[model samples]
Target: MLGLLQRCLVRQGQRSLHSGRPALMAVSSDSGVGTTQNLSESDIHQDIDKRVKKSKVVVFMKGTKEQPQCGFSNAVVQIFRMHGVDDFDTVNVLQNEGIRQGIKTYSKWPTIPQVFLDGEFIGGCDIMIQMHRSGELGETLRKAGIESQISDPPAAKDTTEETTPSTSSTNVKS
Candidate 1:
């Protein structure tokens, strides 16, 4: 049954994690049936390439942009939202096991919630957080032809009112 296969896949993933190998999960083919197949590396690469180029900004996360399934994914979504990037493409890796693993292989990064700007890998959640804090993310988005909503802090204002000193005011000796 599918449940048994899923359990086996989970155990396999756990074993791969402990064995220092990339985890691999089985995914159904595009046939829309319950049948599954082993995707060739080239096929996965092609699929990932198409997805990366689907938009100016692409995110491979655990869930959709509207509803993230994990904290890291949510963080990625929030970072984009902060940048006023709402039209970016999002691939829910949780819905496709092949993509979930294939993305890691494609980017050579061992994590989920991978971000791509202009079809280039930009790293994952931690990297995104670092870029967001360092203001690099906004700049990067700008360079990618995508403007960010975050703006520079306003200059400090002088609160003191400009007024002529009264002649009657005596200067105090310090």
Candidate 2:
């Protein structure tokens, strides 16, 4: 009997997971209310978990690359810059109503500006700076086969400068 009750409760929670409503221990008074009425914590957690594991480098911040909503987020960007990162992905948790809360649960880090490298949770802004200072960041990049901008100059700029001829002319017609 106890097992049957537990299964029923689980089903109810799953049904309400995506409805944007809090999961209740007791059944709602209205049986007409459907799962669409509310979303459970499990739904939010699943959303965050899928994103964290989806990319090689993922930054869960307050804002996107163009605009960071918090000082901590900006600091994370700067640290990545120092390490010469040419490509990375950012998730603006502030924009997502669910992600802002979900990410904390997913990472169990209790903070925004979380950084992940090669699908592994690295840490937040402070950790990033510390790793860069210790030179571990560069080593990690190499191990992941991720080329850093610090190690290699911009190829396009270098090639252009090399191919372009000098505009100034020293030769004079007599």
Candidate 3:
């Protein structure tokens, strides 16, 4: 009975995973929501790989950095801005049907605003948020040679001299 219940639960989870909400690109009417023919997987992978390798920071997003079409993408743009990162390159996935869908498969990440650092797939908005909040994002950028304008100051050194142990002992009243 327990095994049967587990199987049913797994089926429900899979159904939800397959039935995720579609990404709204807010593209021009002419584009008509993925009307462009899809490209071969190998071609798409090659293109994305080249783009990632070519740029120090590459973001596969729904729109350009100047004009992000989705809120999630916009949040990512803002995060980069906060870190004073402006040299990054962004692919407007909304412009092409092949890449729009192919990118998700390429990254195995089911979301837009995918961040790639030094040809490495970092993650999506949530992961970036966590990294920024934990101060790791700035460090990562510095290592990549992108100096952050709002970088954290170096940790302060301890300067106070150690105090000697108390020489006198207090007596307790009976």
Candidate 4:
């Protein structure tokens, strides 16, 4: 009887991992009977969908926005900032198991730091930085109607200042 309860608990935990909802198994003290909670698989699927579509630019990385766990993720964020992008979202893949696996399958890229721009997969850090350096990133932003300003030096301004004529006196005579 005790062995059966242990098995049931393990099964419930596994279900929760995939279902995204804790499987409630009610075990009566005297009766030693258990009841399982029923959760639809669609419920989990829909939640993942909503999370993925919530942001314009979503980066699924190893860590949080404040601290990126991986070097690749750090580099990607830095490049985005250098491109003058202040608005974007990040998903710490380390936090969610489903998202971590689902994103790799969704993007068809087996990498931790995956970047998505405007709901489209934008590849990894190397590809993004390459595009950014080649000026294609700005073009892509324009295509998305994001209106990102490329770094351009401010034009020099002309300042008119009064100049006094210089007079030089010869050694002998002026």
Candidate 5:
């Protein structure tokens, strides 16, 4: 049943990509039956927008936060962990091919493990890594009204004592 859904989703995604039209999603109803739903391109964008805004931090990756499938996805998970952000939402792209493609179109980004902070696109793994290294990620979280658990390093003390000026100087000719 899952395989059938995947195939349908893949075909739908392909058609949407090639024909430049909306795709039909196979939605499973409460009666344990599948039904087709007409999902427009704008609908997908709206859905993505809602999802990104649903949390302060939302990660659309290849797997869940607990078990990321791709290395890039794992890196994103670890970066969030380093910031002590444990309550963020995670959407596993591998579970739904339509979402996997839809997100790319929505964000205009060609990669997975996308990060959204307060409904704003923070970027992918490489961008996240750069932001993390530059302490921008923490600042961004702070701006988003989420405090990062990782504290800043203490300021360096001025330990250098005053030195006397040299009494003699040497001159060289070239």
Candidate 6:
């Protein structure tokens, strides 16, 4: 399990390594998730819809999985890694203002680091933390078609590094 955890972290780090951050070539959405140019609100909604549906597990967060922009996001990412969820996708909400706000409206949850399982909103960091703490996250992941890969439910690990910003934690609106 520890090997799995490390591998996930390493993969997360590598994912951001090759992202071509060139200036927006066309009208593409700020978040790189969209395949087309900047879109209308409805179109953005469609993009988001497509995004969540594309993967069994996805997180709409402040930054990419390689580098989470907030401590809460890091924590959530870590929790997912600890649970052996290495194949999940993440959207960097900070990259696109529309996505940042759009996701809030899409999920009707006021927060970044939003999680989706099987195309359903699983809530934000707070809810994920609650699920992780109560040992429900593992079961939820398995039920959602993501493999838990653990013989027993493991505890959530704090992956927030030293420089992790000092801000309100999960569930605390800051």
RMSD of each: 12.4, 18.5, 11.6, 18.9, 12.1, 13.0
Worst 10-residue lDDT window for candidate 1 reads 28-37
Q: Is candidate 5 or candidate 6 better by lDDT?
A: 6
**Can you write out model 3's per-residue Cα lDDT over 133-165, one digit (the tens) per residue?**
767888889898889776664565665544656
- lDDT ranking, best first: 3, 6, 1, 5, 2, 4
| Candidate 4, pairs of clashing residues | none
TM-score of each: 0.66, 0.60, 0.67, 0.58, 0.66, 0.67
Residue-wise C-alpha lDDT for candidate 2, range 64-136, written one tens digit per residue: 6555555567667766666667477887764454666767777788888898887788998778766665667
lDDT score, candidate 4, position 77: 69
Worst 10 residues of 4 by lDDT: 28-37
Evaluated at residue 115, the lDDT of candidate 6 is 93
Per-model C-alpha lDDT, please? 0.73, 0.64, 0.74, 0.62, 0.71, 0.73
Across 53-119, the per-residue lDDT of candidate 5 in tens digits comes to 8777889876677756556777777777778888888877665666678899999999998999888
| Per-residue lDDT of 104 in model 1 | 94
Query: How much is 30 displaced in model 2, in angstroms?
Result: 38
Error of 1 at 149 (Å): 0.8
